[model samples]
Target: MREYNVAILGATGAVGTRLIEQLEKSSIPVKAVKLLASKRSAGKVLQFNGQDVVVEEATPESFDDVDIVLASAGGAASKKFLPEAVKRGAVAVDNTSAFRMDPEVPLVVPEVNEKAIYDHKGIIANPNCSTIQMVVALKPIEDVAGLKQVIVSTYQAGSGAGQTAIAELDHQAQQHLNGEKMTADIFPVKSAKKHYPLAYNLLPQIDVFEEDGSTHEEWKMVHETKKIMEGDMNSDAVKVNATCVRVPVVIGHGESVFFEVEDSSKLTPAKVKELMQNGAGITLQDDPDNQIYPQPINAEGSTQTFVGRIREDQENPGSYNMWVVSDNLLKGAAANTVQIAEKLVEHDLVRVPAEYYGK
Candidate 1:
């Protein structure tokens, strides 16, 4: 049993905190744990394996002698610190979108593309939280019956935006209940000029809108699905489209996914359910007669992707629909990021080039 030294880059934040919890219970033997955050969060003590670990300011030097780096900082911070960690000989599994689409970095969901982890050049990118759940449900189907197209509409949770967004949702709900004015500031992109209240209402946008009218969140789903499934965005084999929305939920993300199977005659709703039931990291909850199905409330803290509402489109026999749910913070961000690190260790891919060591 070999133990490895690990560092968590954003140890005080929502996803960062979850990463700590996941690592605590993980099968990987952790010799030492380092908690790194920004200067403001430094000196905060977090619990790991029944010991107090103080958060330190993240710098290139923080990666010294670390074997694995689990990074959940924001995109800017990840873009800055992850490379430094890699350069310092630590294999960084990143939860931010900073390096996902980079050809040199591997964007991996362990259940979907574990082999991709071996191809990493010192850094592995974790796909967007929404993309991770959708792909988990779709991967088995894609294998049993070739996938031709995918269309997904997501009802995302406030936690996807971080702790501030979740807290704002709670505050706004209280304001609505007390007949006070609801404030808008975080949902639908915090940096955008216009913000909206997500309490008892839905916003049809997740990230900032692109030039093509699609929000950045939707674009990530579109492109990331392709990258994870076929490993190339331009692959003519499969097409993906998404509409991401922010709902008032606090933890889990719910999605309605419609997909077309290339070989329609063989793949049916029952077969799809059977495939998913046996799929890794997936739980089949489709029992229409008993009113059993996946829901956000039921999936709050679970790591497995809950899938239900399996049915084929009546008009198009080739097209089918299903519902998917998972905790956005756990499986979507922290759990998946940690899973990539686990895969790296399992496959003995945790080491980088010699030049990166002590450089």
Candidate 2:
């Protein structure tokens, strides 16, 4: 087995921490794990493969001896250092929106489009958390029935907003129980003038709204779906519209998805359930008679994308309704990035071309 040196950027953030945990158990031979973060977080000790590694300030030089970089440090950090990683001869699998929409970057879900990994221009973009689970659930169906359109609404967890948002939820919940006034400093939109309490509350907006009346979070799902599943640069074949809401849950995201297919007569909800039961990284939990369906509370800390509530749409012949759930930080971000790195090693997709790294 060939050994690869890996670097993890944003080592302190929620998804970044999970990335470290996943990489520790990864099949790829990780020769060295370098944890990189902001200046303030430098010297922070994080354990990887049972050894404590001190976090370092992120810089172009950070990738000097790195072979693969898993970055979850947010879009700004990815935009700054991902190219630098590439220039220094490391392939960056970024968990940020910075390169997701770029025509050159592949928005990948390994189950749906692992082949996209071959096309990376040294940096590969992971799909949005919500988008990842949905596509994983829908991919098998799309292969069988031929997808036409997707309409999805997400019940996203507070943790998706990051650690501060999770703290805000805890603060608000405790305050509400004590009959004290609740304060929210991180949620909906953290920089917006007003923040709403996330405990026992639903905020229709996840990210700031754009001019098209869709919030940026919603638009990520919309555009990312088309890119990952359909691979449509022209954006004409697949249609997607998403409504993203922030819920009080701390880990998993639940989505209610409605999709239309070309061959409705051959497909049924039962067949879909059977397909999901045998699909990779997916579990079918749709036993409505026993009162079971995919729920966020049951999905925390798990890598599986859970699907349930498979039924035909009432008004549309070729359409079906389903529920999708997964840990936003695991299968959605870190696990997907790690899976790509494993694929790269297994396939020998991009070998360091003749002294490319001056190795």
Candidate 3:
């Protein structure tokens, strides 16, 4: 097998760290590993294959000689550097929302849309963490029955924000334990005018709200799901609605999903479980009698999306309800990013397509 030079952007952050760790266990034929972060993280040393690799400050020239770039940096960095990386001959799997809705960029969830990796001009987008797990859980059903509508309520982990938010959650927990007023800093939105404590509390907001009163995170879930499953970014082919909330957990994200199948409108819970059992990259945990449903703690480190609590919606004949859970950092971002890179290699799409040059 031939090897490719891989780069990890935002190499010091939560998702970036997981990207490095995921690459260690991944099957990509990696010739060399390069770690890229901001200047503060540049001198830091990290490990891949048990050897030390120094993190470098990312620049436009960072993509030179890099075959694959797994980027989990902020949207700003991705918007600025990914195009340069592509121009310099590297195919990037971006884990930011910067280009997800772009008509030319394919927002991919490996289990749901592996074939979409071939459509990359220079960048393949890893869907949002919440969107990734939801699509993985939905793909099996969408494959068998056609999707009509999807409504998801997410219990997102603080780690979804970044390492700082997770740490702040811990601090707030301690403060509450000691009867001190908890301080607010990163939760909700960092740059927003106000912040809130996430310990023993849920923030109904995930990101700053848009003009329509929906947070950006919620909007991503809606549109990203449509693009990945239906390949129609703005089309109502599969109606997606999301309510994103920040839970007190540190790593795993849990979602309550209700979906209606168009083709198999009469699809029962049993059939749903059967599809999930045979579904790629998903685990079935639907034994309610034994209290064995998917939960965030149990899904803390696993790459597979966990689905359970399957039942038919009583009010709606064609609708079913279920719970989906996965490690936000793993299958949601880093693992999904690396999986796209693996698919790219499997399909020999290491270079930007000439057709995408003008995009």
Candidate 4:
């Protein structure tokens, strides 16, 4: 196996931590693992291959000699370090909203758009967490029925908000149980003065609401889905609408998806199940009599997208309903980002002129 040096930017974040864990079990031979984060997190110890790897402050020069960089930090972090990593000969797979829409960057789901990896100019963008699972569940069906439109509602987890948000939820829950005045400091919108309880409550907004009233998270799913499926956002073949909500779950993001196909008579629930079960990056968990289905707890730490509860829409003849679930930190971000790096290697798109990554 070929060995490659790897870097994990935003190493202390939720997705970043999971990315390291996945790398531990990955088939790719990792020569070295560099953990990069902010200056405050530098010197922090994170375990890899049973050894403690100290986190270092990230800088444009940090990518020297790195073969692959899995960046799950945020849009701002990606905007800052991606070019730097690329300049240093490291191919970056960013798990942020930064480059998904860039005409030059391929927004990929390995199962659906792995070939797009060949087009990477040193950087690739992973699709949104909700968008990733939905596409995994819908891709096989689209191959048969021909998708025209899709509407999705996502139940996102607290972990998606970062670690501090998770702690805030736990703190508020304990206060709620103790009959004390509970406070919310990390939800609804952290920057927005008012926060709310996530436990025993569903917050209808994920990111800050835009001028059009849709949250940025919802818009990311809508636009990113089209970009991933069709390769261009302007394609007329796909139309999507999404409502992103935050729930108290610590892991998976659950999506209730409704979709319309160009032809319905050619497909059925059983056929969908068969295709999905055999599909890449997806696990079909649709047994009804045994009361089997995809749940958040069942999806934790797993990279496969879980899909179940598939049924035909009663109101619309060519429409269907299904539930899609996944470990947002894994398949939604980390695993997908790693897969892009692997694809870059497999397609020979990564190893550019060494000077291409140098300052």
Query: What is the C-alpha local distance difference test score of candidate 2?
Result: 0.87
Give the Å error, residue 84, model 2.
Answer: 0.8
In angstroms, the error of model 4 at 117 is: 0.7
Can you tell me which runs of candidate 2 are displaced by over 4 Å? 232-236, 350-359
Clashes of 3: 0
Model 2: per-residue Cα lDDT over 73-104, one tens digit each? 88899988988788778888899889999877
> Would you list the C-alpha lDDT of every candidate in the order shown?
0.89, 0.87, 0.89, 0.85
Give the 10-residue window scoring lowest on summed lDDT in candidate 4: 350-359
Q: What's the CA RMSD of model 4 in angstroms?
A: 2.2
- Write down the TM-score for model 3: 0.97
TM-score, cand. 2 vs. native: 0.95
Worst 10 residues of 2 by lDDT: 350-359
lDDT, candidate 4, 1-359, per-residue tens? 56899999999998888889888877677889999999989999999999999999999989999989899887898999989888877888888888888887888998887777766677888888888888888888777777899999999999888888888888888988999887888897778877888887999988888899999999898888888778622346578999999998888999999989878887777777788889888888998999999999999989999989999887787788899999988888888878777777676676754434223
Writing each residue's lDDT as its tens digit, candidate 3 over 1-359 gives 87999999999999998999899998899999999999988899999999999999999998899999999889999999998888888899999989989888988887777777776799888888999889888888877777888999999999999999989999999999999999998888999899989999999998889899999999999888878877722334688989999999999999999998887554777899999999989999999789999988899889999999999988887799999999999999999888888888888999877765335
lDDT of 1 by residue, 137-207 (tens): 99898888888999899999999999889999999999999999999888878899998899999999888
Where's the lowest-lDDT run of ten residues in candidate 3?
Answer: 228-237
User: In model 3, where do residues sit more than 4 Å from their true spots?
Assistant: 232-236, 264-266, 357-359
